[model samples]
Target: MVQINFAQKQVNAKIVYYGPGMSGKTTNLEVIHQRAPEPNRGDLTSISTDGDRTLFFDFMPLDLGTVAGMRTCFQVYTVPGQVYYNSTRKLVLQGVDGVIFVADSSPDMMEENLESLRNLQENLSEYGRSSEEIPLVIQYNKRDIPGALPIEVLEEKLNQRGAPAFEAIANTGQGVFPTLKALAAAVLDSLHKSSGSSVPASAPAAQPVAAPQAATAQPSAPAPAAAPAPQRQTISMSQTGFHKAPSLPLQGAAAPSEAQAPDKGARPPQNAATTPGPQALGGLQLKGGSEGDGGGLRMAQPATPPAPEQPPTQPSLSMAVPPQPPAAAPAPTQAPPATATATAKPQTPPANRPATPGSMMRPDGGSPPPRRAPASKSFPSKVQEAHATPKGGKPKSAALTVLIVVASIGLGAALGSFVLQIL
Candidate 1:
C-alpha cells in the first residue's frame, strides 16, 4: 500500500522480501543497509517472529528522487523463509506494494524455493490482493556457489509473473543494489498506473452537478468544471521521470498573452532582421565578411528599436558614410545614435576633422566647413570672458561715460583759444 502525507510532502511505500529459509533474504537487507549512505538509510531493525527473526529498514533512493513534488521513500522488510512462519508472512504481506522473491540457487534447495513461491501466492490471496496484480521481482541468489543451479533454470520455474529477474551473491553485496533499485522502480510504476485508472471512474459523479447548477443563478461559472469534474494532481511516470501530484489548494493559469509566448518564437527575428538589408553577409563566409557581418549584426539590433524615436537621423548617417558604400548597411545605421554624441563633443572642436562624420553632415552636401568651424569650441572660452570683466556688466557701461567726458574737455579748450586771441 502507498501512503501520501500532505503535511510532510512525502510518499511512503513498502516492499517485502519473500523466499525459503537460508535463501539470502536477510543477507540482502544487511548488504543494502551497510552499503547505502548513512543519511539515505535508517536503522536496521529486527523482529522476533516466533523463535526465528525477521529484518526490515527504511531507505531513500536518489534514482527515484522525487515523484510529483513529494519525496519518495520505502521500507524493505524480509520474511523468514521457513515454511512454519506462514502466519508471520501473511502479517508482513498485508499491505505490501511490491515483492522481491529471493530464490536459493543451490541444486539441493530447488524444492524449498518452489514451496516458498507457492506459500507467497497463498498468503497474498488471503488479503484479497492477486499475485498477478501487485508489482513483483525475482532474484536468484548464491550464484557464486560451486555447481549452483543455472539462472535460466531458476527463471523457468520462478518467473511465471514475467517480472524482471537478477542473479546475485548477496553475502558479498554483488547484486544487492540493482535488485532493490529494480523493485523500487516497479512499485512506483504500479502506484502511478493504479491512480490513473481510477481518475476516470470518479469523473461521472461530477457530471450530474452541472444540471443542478444550471438551475441556479451562476450556470456559466460551473459549466466548464463539469469537464473532467474530478480534478486531482495527475501522476506521470516514464524512464525519464515520475511526477505524482496531490490535491493542491489553489492554482492559477498564466495570462493569455503569456500563455501564447511560444507561438511568437518566430516573431523577434522577423522584426529584428527586417532592417538589416537581406543578409549582407552571406552564410558563405570570407575572412573579412565574417567580422563585417558580425559587427553589422551587433550594431543593427540596438540601433533599430531606437530608430523610431528620431526618424530623421538615418538619412544624415547614410549621406555621411558615402565613402564606405561597399561596407555593410548596418554600420551606417549605427551612426544615427551619434547626434547626441556629436553635440556633446562639439566643445573640444577639432581643427579640420569633422566632429563625428555621420552627425555633422547633411543630405545636400552643403555647409560642410560652416557647421564644423563653430561647433568645435565646446568649453575653454567661458573662463576667458569671466577673467576679462570687472563685475562683468559694469565694465561695458563705464566705457561709454569716459568717451563723453573726453569730448567736453576738447570743446572748452577751443573756446579759450578764441577769447585770448581777441584780447
Candidate 2:
C-alpha cells in the first residue's frame, strides 16, 4: 500500500527483519545503523511496555543511490521477537516491500526459527500478501557462534527453492550489508520490471505537510506523452505457480511522513492514529486483513471464497533476470596422427557435408586417379566354362591375366632394345 513517487525520482522500499525472540533481529538493525554512513542512516528507536522487552518495532532509513534517476531509500524495521506479540508481528508485515527472515544459527534455536518462519507465511497469507512474490532474503544470524549448523542444512530446511541466503554475524557486521544490498536490489529491480522503468525505483523526497485524505492520494500529474507504456508484459499467474493476493487499497506512500523528515531527533508519536473505513467491493476480509484488526478496533465480515475456477493469477516474485551461467574452460584439441599410412584411415566426414562436384582430394594436394570400373571378366556361360577345364580337371588358371602380363613384358623389352641401338 506504500506509494513511491516516480515523478520526484524517489522510491521508498520496506524491508523487515523478522525472526523469533533473541534471534538477533534487533541486533542486526543496530549493527546496520552503526556501520552505515551517517548520511544514509537515521536514529534507532524502540518501544517497550511493562518490561516485557521491546514490543512494537524499530526503524531506520538508508539512502541507496539513484536507480535509473530516482533516489532510492530503504526503510528497515524489526518486528517484536516475543511470542506474546503475535498480533503485533502480523500488524507490522502489512505493505512489506521485502523480507529478511533472520534465523538464529544456534543449534538449540532451530525450532524457534522454524516456528518464526511458519508464522511469517501465515501472517503473509492473512494479510493477503503472497509470501513467494515478496522480495525475500534469508539471513542466518549469529553464524559466528561455535557449534552452529552448516549453512547447507539451514538452506535445505528453510530455503527450498534456493532464495538468496546469507551468513551474518550481525554483531560484527559480517554479511549484513550484503543481505541489505541483495534485498534492496531485488525490490528495485522488481519494481522497475513491473513499472517498465529504465532505472530502479527510488524513495521520494520527504513531502511537505498535507491533509490526511490528500496524504493517501498519488500526486496528480500527467505522464510524459513521449514515453510509451511498456510493451513487454509479465507472465500471468495462470501460467505460473504463484497465487495472487487481492491488492490492498492505497494507504499513505511510505511509512507516515513522521518516520522520514528533517528532524532526526524527533520521537515517534505515542501511537499512530488509525481510523477504520468500510471494506472495498470484491476484497475479502481475512485475519490481519485490516489495519484496525490488529488492535480489535473493529471486526469486519468473514471472507468469501474468490470466484470459482478462475483463481486470481498471482504476480511473479522470482525475478527472471537473465541468469549467468558458470564460466566454461576451453576444450582441449586432439593432435593429428604423426604420420599417415593406407590403414591410417581418414576420419569420417561431418554429418552435415554437402556433395561436391568432384571426388575429395588427399591431404598432399594430389588428385587421386579417377576410380575405374573393377576389372571383372564375365564367362560366356556357366556350362561353357565347365567344359573349358583342362584334362586334369583343373580349370585354366587366370589365362587372361597371364597373357596381359606377357604382352606388357615384350613391349618393355622391345622399347629398351630400340633405345640401345639408337645410342
Candidate 3:
C-alpha cells in the first residue's frame, strides 16, 4: 500500500527485497545504508541468528525529495531467504508497494533463484495480490563471481514480465543504487497514475491552470483588466467542482461603469424594477414613480399616523374633595353584658368507675400507671440456651466408667460359653 499523509505532507511506501538464502539480499541493504546520504537515510536494523543469517528481516528507510508538494519516503525491507523461514518472508510481504528480486547469478544458485521466484508469487497470492500488478525490479547479484551465468539466462529464468533488471555485485555496491532507483521511480509513477483515477469524471481538468493565474494576478488593481480575470477564474473553478471564489469587489464596480453609457440615472430605476435583482450599492433604494407625482427623486422617510384629539371637560368646584375622617364605626353593641346566671355544679365521678389495679384514682386526683414486665425470649433463642453447657465444668468421668464395666461383663460371658463348648 502507498500511504498519503495530508497533515504531514508526506507519501510513504513499502519495498521489499526478496530472493533465495545467501543471495546478497542483506548485502544490498548494508551497501545502501552505508552509501546513502546521511540526511536521506535512517538507521539500518537487522534481526539475524548467530550465523549472521537474516532470521527475520532488515529495514532501511530512504527519503526522496518532494513530489507534487508531498515528501516521499520509501521503507525498504529484505526478508530472510532460508526455505524454513517462509512464514517470516510472507509476513514481510504484507502491504508491499514494490519488489526487488535479488537473484544470485552464480551458476550454482540458478535452481534456488527459480524456487524463490515461485515462492514470491505464492506468498503474494495469499494477500490477494499479484506480482504483475505491483512495481518490480530484478538485480542479478554476485555477478563478479567466477563462472557466473550470463545476464540473458538470468533474465529468462527470472524476469518473465520484462521488469527492469540490473547486474549487481551487492558486496561491492555495484548496480545497487540503479536497482533501487528504478523500483522507487516505478512505485511513485504507479501511485501518481492511480491517484488520477480517483478524481471525479465530471471535474474540469483545466481548473488547476487557472489557480496559478489567479495567484499571479493578485497585485494588479486596474478594474477593467482585473474584472475579467476573476470571472474566468471563478467559472473554471466552478466547472472543476471546486468551491467558487468570492466575487471581487472591483468586479461589481465594473458593472456600474458599463451601465453608465445608457442614461445612467434613468437606467438604474428601470433595471431595478425590471430585473428585481439585489438592492443598489450603498444601501440606496430605487422606487418607480407614479404618473401624477413629478418623477423626481426624493429622500424617503417612514410614515407615522397622527394622534387622536379629545374633547375638553368643564372644571368642577369640588374636583378636589377634602378627605373626611373615616366615620367612627358604631360601638360594638356592648357585647350584650355577659349574663351573671349561676354555673351548674361540677358533675360527680361515675358510681361504677372500674376498680382495676392501675385504674384506681389517688386522693390527689391523679395516679401514675404501673410498668409492665419485659416479653419472654424467642423459641430459637430458648433452644440454643438449653443446649449450652457451662464452659468451666469437668469432663463426664461417670459415663466413661459405665461403658468400661459393660464391656468387661460381655467379654466374661463370651469366655465362659467358649469353655463349656470345649468341655
Candidate 4:
C-alpha cells in the first residue's frame, strides 16, 4: 500500500526483501543502510536470534526524493527466511508495494530458492496481490562464492516472470545499489501507473553511495557495470512486450524529431509549407517597386476637368388652386319623426312584475327590476351567518344584548317592588 498524506506532502511505500535462510537478505539491507547518507537513511531495526539470524523482520527506511510534489519514503523490510517462519514472512509482506526476492546462487541452495519463490507467490495471492501485478525484482546473491550456479541456471529456475534480474554479492556490497535503484524505479513506475499520473522516465535515478572498504573486501565477478543514466525516456508494458514511450518535450521547449512527427490519426495542416502574402488589387503586382509607382502597372489617364459652375435660373410663378377636401357623402336618410303626444306620460312598472327577495325597491317613482345577490358572495355570507347565529334565529351578539336588557328589566322591577314596599 502507498500511503499519501496530503497535508504533510509525503508518500510512504513498503518494499519487502524475501528469501530462504542464509540467502543474505539481512546482508543486503545492511549494505544499503551503510552506503546511504545519514540524511537519506534512518536507523535500521532488526529482530534476530543469538546466531544473528533474523527472527521477525528487519526494517530500514530510505528517502527517495520527491516525485509529483510529494516526498517519497520507502520502508524497506527483510522477512525471516527460515521455512518455519512463514507466518512472520506473511506479516511482513502485508501492505507491501514491491518485492525483492534475494535468492542464494549456490548450487546446493537451488531447491531452497525455488521453495522460497513458491512461498512468495502463495503469500502474495493470499493478500489478493500477485507477483505479476506488483513491482518485483530478483537478486541472485552469493555470486562471489565458488561453484555458484551461473546466472542462466538461476533464471531458468526462478525468473518465470522475466522481471529485471541483477547479479550481486551482498557480502561485498557489489551490485547492491543497482539492484536497489532498478527496484525503486519499477516501484515508482507502478505507482504512477496506478495513480494515472504521467510517469517521468526522464527523472534521474538515484546513485548508490560507495560502501566502506571493509564492506567491499571481496570482489565478485567485476561488479556488473552500473546502468547508464536514463535519457528523456518513458517505459510502458503491454501484453506484447515492453515499449518505450515517446519522450515528451518540456514546456516551451522544442520537441524531439520523433515527437514532432504528425500523428497518424491527425489531419495535416493546410498550406503547411507557405504563409499567405499580401494581396494585390486591380490586377497589380506590387513586388520590388516604389510605393508611388503602383508596382509599375498601367493606369487609366485622368478625365478632363468638369465645366465651370453656372448661375441660378429664375422661374415664373402662376396662381395654383389648393386641393379641396373630399366631398362628404350625402347625409344618411332621416327616419320619419316619432309622433309626440300633447302631454308625455311617465313610465311605470308593470303590475304583473314580481320583486326579487332580499332586494330593496328604488325610490324613483318606479320600481327598478329587483337585483339578485351575487352568487359567489351569497353562499360564503350564508355560511358565515349560520356559524355566527346561535340555535336562535338571531346572532350571538344580539342574544347577548337581549339578555342584558332582560337583566336590566328584572333588576328595575325588583328595585320598584322594594321601593313600593318601603313606601
Candidate 5:
C-alpha cells in the first residue's frame, strides 16, 4: 500500500520482508532500524509465539530524507516464516507496495527458500496482485555461511521477475541499504507514473504549470447576430372586406376603395371588429392582406328575425354582401329601377337593410340615385312599434316620427311651388 498524504506532504508505503523460518527476515529489519538515524526511525515492535515463530509480524517505521520535497516513510513488516504461519503471512502481505525476499544462502535451506517463495506468490495472488508488477528485491542472506549456494544458482531458481538481487549478511547490515534503496526508488517511480505528476504530491507548483495554456486561449467569437424580427401581419380595408367611409359612390362602376379616399378626421368606428387574424391554411403562413374579405364577408343577420326567403331566380343578387362601413349620419343610397331592376324583380327586405352590392351602382353620367323616405325607416323604430303599447302610451315617439315626415313633405312641396313660381 502506497499512500500519499497530501495534507502532511508525506508519502507512506508498506514494505514487507518475507522468507522461510529462521531465514533472517527479522534480522534485516532490526539492522535497518538500528542503522536508521534516530530522528528518522520509529520504535521497532515484535510479537512472537511460543514455538519461536513470529505469531503476528514485526513492524517498524523507517523515515527517509525528503524526496522531491515530500517526507518519505516506509512501514516495514516481517511475516512469520514457518509454513504453519501461512495465514499470518498473507495477512501481513495485504496492501504491500514492495517486497524484500530474504532467502537463506545455505545449500541445505534451498528447499525451504523455494517453499517460502511459493508461499509469497500464493499470498500475493490472494490479494489479486501479480509478483510481476510489484517492486521486489531479493537478498541472499546468510551469505557468510561457508556452504552457501552460488548467486547464479539462486537467481536461476528463485528470481521471479529478474528482480534486483543483493548478497547481504542481515546482522552486519551488508548490502541491506542497497536492497532497501532500490526497492524504495522503484516504488516511488511507480507512484509518480500512476499520478502523472512530475514532482511529489507535496509540491503545490505542479498544477500551476498549466496556467499559461489557459492564458493563451483565444476569446470566444462574437455571438451570432440576433435573429431577425419575425414578419408582422398588417390589416387593410380591402383585405377585411370593410371600409371606413359613410357611403360608396353612386357610380358603383368602380371599387369603393378606388372611389372614396380615407377620411383622416374620422376615428375608427366603435363597432368595428378587431382586425381579422391570419388563420393557418394547411400549416402554411400567408402574407398580411393577401386574402380579401369578400371570401367570407356577409351581412350580420338580426338574431330574432327569420332568414329571408332568397330569390331563387336572381342568385347573384340574393347572395348577401359584406357589412357596410360605419357612418355617424349615413345617407342611404337607393337602388334605381335601372341597374338592379333590370336584372331581377327581387322583393326588397324589411328592417336593417342588407349590404348593397356594388353591381347595383349606376353607370357614369347618370343622375345620382334617388333617396326614398319609406326606405329610410330605421329598423329600431319597427322594433319600438312591436314592443310598445299602441294606445297613445308610446304616442310621443309616433308623434315625433309623424312630425319629421310632415316637415319633410312640406319642405318638398314648398320647394316644388317655388320652382313653379320661378318658371
Candidate 6:
C-alpha cells in the first residue's frame, strides 16, 4: 500500500488504469508520462510475456502542485490488459485510491470491455472496496479510429455504477492530460476533504506540495475559477461523432464555464488527437469524510452524505489500515527452583536373603526376581566379533572373513549336526 506522510506534508495516492487487453492502457501511461512535467513523473516500466503484455503494472508518478500547504503526488498504474492475467490485475488494485477504466472504443470490443468491468468489480470487492466509494474515472480510448462505438453505448454498459468517464485518444495526448488532471484533482480533493478544512482549494495552480510538504502559501481566498475550475482546451466536433455541431472556436484564453461540461463517457481516445479531455468527469461528487470539517481526525468523522442528485453506491477504492500486530503477550514467570529434597538413603538388602533359582536380591530391601529383558538379535554378537579382529592385517582380516563364512555354514550345519549329537 502507498503511504502519504502527512508529517512531511505530502499526500500520495494510487490511480490505476484498468480495462480489456490492447485497450490502450499502456498508451495512456505512455502519454501521461511524456506530457507530465518531467520532474513530476517517474520512469515507465513494462513486462511482456507470451501470455500477457504486462508482467507487472506500469508506474508513473505525477506531481500535482500542492494542496493545503502539502505536496501531493499521484502514482498512475495500468493493470495487465490480458484477460488471463486477472490475478495480477487484482493485486495491482489492492490499494488503489482511484481508477481509470481505459475501454476499447471499437464496437467489436464491447464484450471484452464488459468482461473487464466485471473483473474489476470482483477484484475490488475481494479487497473490500466497491467501485462506488473510490474516485473512479473512465477513458474510452481510440476515439481517433473510424469504427469507434458510440460513447453513450459504452457508458450504458460500463458505467452502470455511475463514476466519471472520459473520451480520449491516449496515443497523441488528446484527452490524456485532462483525464490525468481530473483524476489527480479528484484524488487530491478526496485527500483534502478527508483531511478537513485546512486544505486550500486553489493549491492546484500553486507551488508543488513538493516531495510531500514544504509549500509556500499566503492563505488567500480560493481562486475565483478554483472551486469547480474547468481545465480548458480546443476541440473539433467531428471527433465526437457529431455530424454538424460546429467546431468550438478557439478562444484566446477563456476557461470552461460550469455549463460547458462534456457528455458522459467510459473510455479514452485510442490515438494521438490532442483534443481537450472531458470536463464532465470532474462533476462527480464524492462523499465527504473530513476536509469539510474545520479540521478533524479521519477516524472521528463520518463520511458526508451523498449529494441528493447522485445516489450512493459502493466505493470502488477504499483504504484499510493494515491490521496492527497484536500486542506481545506477557512473558511467563519462572517458578523458584525446587528445593533439594533429602532422598532417603536406599536401604541395603539383608545379607541372609535367600537366592531363588531365577532371582537375585536387590540393593534395596525388596527381594524381587530378576526380570530377563527380551532377547536382542544375534547380529550384535557378530558385529562385536568383527570389530574384535586383531591388528595383524592379513591374518586378522582373513580370519574375520573366514569366521563370517564359517559362522554362516555352522549356523546351517548346527541345525542338522547338533540334532544328531543331541539324539
User: Cα lDDT of all candidates, in order?
Assistant: 0.46, 0.47, 0.51, 0.51, 0.50, 0.48
Arranged by lDDT with the best first, the candidates are 3, 4, 5, 6, 2, 1
lDDT of 2 by residue, 1-423 (tens): 334897888888888989888676765675565446556665444433322134677666778677568887888888987888899899889889888888887788788888998999899999887777776767776654556787766766876534556665443334455566556655655565444346523432111111122211121111222111111111111111111111111122122211112111011111111211111111112111111112110111212332212212211111222334434312111112221111111111122222212212211122111111001111111222323434433434567668889999999999999999999
Where model 4 places Cα greater than 4 Å from the true spot, the runs are: 65-68, 194-197, 201-423
**Best-matching candidate per lDDT:** 3
**Per-residue CA lDDT of candidate 6, range 99-205, in tens?**
88888878888999999988888999999878766766667776655557776677668766544455655443345544555556556566554444766645443
Better of 1 and 6 by TM-score: 6
Quote the lDDT for 27 in model 4: 67
List pairs with backbone clashes in candidate 1.
68-243, 68-244, 347-378, 349-376
> For candidate 4, lDDT tens digit of each residue in 1-423?
788899999999898898888887876786576456666776565555423456678787899777669998999999989998899899999999888888887788899999999999999999998777877767877654556687767777887665656665454344555566666766665666544357444532311111112211121111223332322111111110111112111222121222111111011111211111111011111111112221111111112221112111111112233444444312211111121101111111122223222111111111111111000000011222323433444677788999999999999999999999999
Give per-model TM-scores: 0.44, 0.46, 0.46, 0.48, 0.46, 0.49
For model 5 the local lDDT of residue 65 reads: 66
Kindly give the stretch of ten consecutive residues in candidate 1 with the minimal lDDT sum: 281-290
Candidate 5 lDDT, 86-129, residue by residue in tens: 98789998999988888887788899999999888888999999
TM-score, model 4 to reference: 0.48
RMSD in angstroms, candidate 4?
A: 45.6
The superposed Cα distance between candidate 1 and the true structure at residue 129, in angstroms, equals 0.7
What's the CA RMSD for each of the models?
32.9, 32.0, 48.1, 45.6, 49.8, 32.3
382: Cα error in model 2, Å: 99
